[model samples]
Target: MKSVTILLYDGFSNMVLSCLLEPLRAVRDQSQSALHWHIVTPHDGPARSSSGLNIAPDLACKDVIKSDLLMVVSGYGYRQHAKPENLRPLRLLTRQAASIVAADTGSWLLASAGLLDDQTATIHWGVISDFTEEFPKVRPSYERFVKHPRISTCGGASTALELMLAMISEQFGPADAFIASTMFLHDAAQQQSTGRGPNRLEGKGTAQLRQIVNRMVETIETPLSLEELAQQSGLTRRTLDRLFQAELAMSPGRYYQLMRLTHARELSTSTDYDLREIALRCGYADASALGKAFRKAFGHPIRKSRGSRPH
Candidate 1:
């Protein structure tokens, strides 16, 4: 059986841990004896997560080398907890493992050990800049997740699950991945096909409405006005507005504006761009306008929101 070791510690995100494990469990349940998982920690003790959930590790870090895959799961205090002392052993373990994956902030641990030196890596979008600043040797991509030569890094909880699903697809087949999605109650077609993460086009609407949402997402960095959006959709302004409200429970203009803000938030946290640059890229006239909208929507200023260290 293929063995996967998930590294856990204090302040780990329980949701991310679940996302990575569920698909793998599905793989095992479907294929019978195809895969197995083991949870590891610095010490075999109760590891507390940032969300106040604690998990017991099955083994210590020193014993993690026996696994076929090693995935380090991390959260807010990762840098402090996932330090050189703790990572060196895991880094050594990497030599014997089939693949090493980092869930969310755990990418930092991999980068810290020089594992991502020449590999494409990603982490939680909120900490991307700090990660880049700290590890200039690594290439940072805007993808939700990226799998390199021997390393895989994911952006957030959602992408963490995608990485797992992609792994299942690679190991078993596309069919297995699709089956796992159905068991997980996710859109299998959307999960594997759409490059965008899930829920980007979630609304009970017609095909034309889905196309309109797609177009809006495409133009997120350089948003179109309501009139232009409707024109592109081959619908009148009044009709488009009515459809958006009826289907999405929001006006077209509001949806478009929120799309821009979402793009701005992702860009702000995932890239080295400043507020001004992000604003320009997200179709805002200036930083101040973007800041106002961002604060109003997220209940925090754009500057403060970047590099979210988890509550």
Candidate 2:
């Protein structure tokens, strides 16, 4: 039996740990194998999770000698809860594991322990930039899950399940993975084998528009006109205009311009770029033109009060 230990801290997110463990339980039940797992806390007392749920651990961190896999889970208020003293044992345990996994901001713990150097990893998308700025040597990946043989890291929540399912598929078979998926009902309902899954929007012709919108966001530093966007997307200008009006309740040109202005404001306040350069990069002829548009749209100058970072 392979042993798995989940390192739990005061602010750990229970959902991530559950997502990681539940599938393994399902797999174990189907195979009737002794897949051992133990929840380890810094101490013997119950640890509080982000959702205000308190969990009692099976063991203390100091008692964990060796494990095949160690999953570290973290959440909001993690910085306040995570102490080097409490994590020191897990840091040592990481070296002995067949693989180390971090869910959500758990990467912070790994990075702090100096375990992620030169390895590709990822965290929740919301904290990507901050994590990058803090850990320069670690190559940050945008995938929901990134595994380099020994170290497996994921963004958050469902991505943890995705990582497990992918790993299970490799160890077992795609059919068994699909069975696991059916039990979880996550990607399961992609087939009828899993009962009625959650209702998902079929996108109703909005999928293509969403793809185009994503491209516009990426090209914010080099804004494109509606006609140019339509040409690039291989859609007629009229079709693009109608799609925007129906889905976004705005003209294509208006939506595109707003996206550019939004990115310009983000760059101005968060980055050290100059106003004129920001304007030119956003496709404005001059800084004044960009400022006027910015004020008209947001009722404030680009360099005025700092804007809340996008979530």
The lDDT for every candidate, in the order shown, is 0.74, 0.72
Give the 10-residue window scoring lowest on summed lDDT in candidate 1: 184-193
- RMSD in angstroms between candidate 1 and the native structure over all alpha carbons: 18.4
lDDT (Cα, tens digit) per residue for candidate 1, span 67-152: 67888888888778667676665666677688888888888888888888977888999999999899999999889889765788
- For model 2, residues 72-180, the per-residue Cα lDDT tens digits are 8877755654567656766667876887888888887788778899889999888889889988989999988897788889977789888888777776544335445
Question: What total of clashing residue pairs does each candidate reach?
Answer: 0, 0
Angstrom error of the Cα, residue 6, model 1: value is 0.7
TM-scores for every candidate against the unseen true structure: 0.60, 0.60
